[model samples]
Target: MIVSLHSYIAFLALAVVLLAFINALNGFLTGREFQQKRDRSISLAGVAFFHLQFLIGVIVYFVSAKGFYALSEVGIGNLSSEARLLALEHPTTNLIAVALVTIGWSRHKKASSDKAKFKSVALFYGIGLVLILSRIPWSQWV
Candidate 1:
């Protein structure tokens, strides 16, 4: 159940993160004044979904046999490439990505100018998105 939730929520979280990144990039490219409502709404949506994903992942880590148990049973060296990805790389990288997203949101809140705000969102969220994508268990996920 937790795995299913994590699998599904991963889609929603990734989609929102990508959308937020694109929206920020658009704002930057267009030189648009950052409207609090639009910017905050997008950022908040991404953050909320990401938090949900993280919570599901935490549960999955403990509950899914393929998670921590596998790590303990086989040790890192014994895991197959795919198993290593699902058990370790995906979760760790995603956690870091979420942290980056949070920092981006917080920094955007404190930014003095529209350009600064957009840059904050664009740079941080962009990196976060890349990190998330890099670690996703693509073969299993799809």
Candidate 2:
């Protein structure tokens, strides 16, 4: 049940983060005045969802057979590509991605200029999205 929830949250996290990244990028590129309500809300949603997903993922890591168990049983050097991904890369990368998104949100809040806020969201969230994408277990999820 938790695993399923984790998977479902992954979709939400990805969608919102992607949306936030695109919106920020567009705003930055166009030099548009940031609509504080809309922009802040969107970015907040992305960070919230991703952070929730990451928390669930951490729980799953400790409990799932494919996560910590595989890492322990097979060992890092012995793991197949798929096992390595599930046990190590996916969690590690997503943890970093979550941190990046959170940092972006913090930076955006601190930025005085609209362009700087947009740029902060665009660059950090965009990189977070890429990292999340690079590590996703496509076969398992999709």
What are the per-model C-alpha RMSD values against the true structure? Answer: 1.0, 0.7
lDDT of 1 by residue, 1-142 (tens): 7788889888899999899999999998999999878887997898889888988898898898879988999999999988898889988998898899899989998999998899898999999999989988787779
Worst 10 residues of 2 by lDDT: 7-16
lDDT of 2 by residue, 1-142 (tens): 9999998988888999999999999999999999979999999999999989999999999889999999999789999999999999999999899899999999999999999999999999999999999999999888
lDDT of each: 0.89, 0.94
| RMSD (Cα, Å) of model 1 | 1.0
TM-scores of the models, in the given order? Answer: 0.95, 0.97
- The TM-score, computed over Cα atoms with residue i paired to residue i, of candidate 2 is 0.97
Cα error, candidate 1, residue 127 (Å):
0.6
Off by over 4 Å in 2: none
Give the 10-residue window scoring lowest on summed lDDT in candidate 1.
1-10
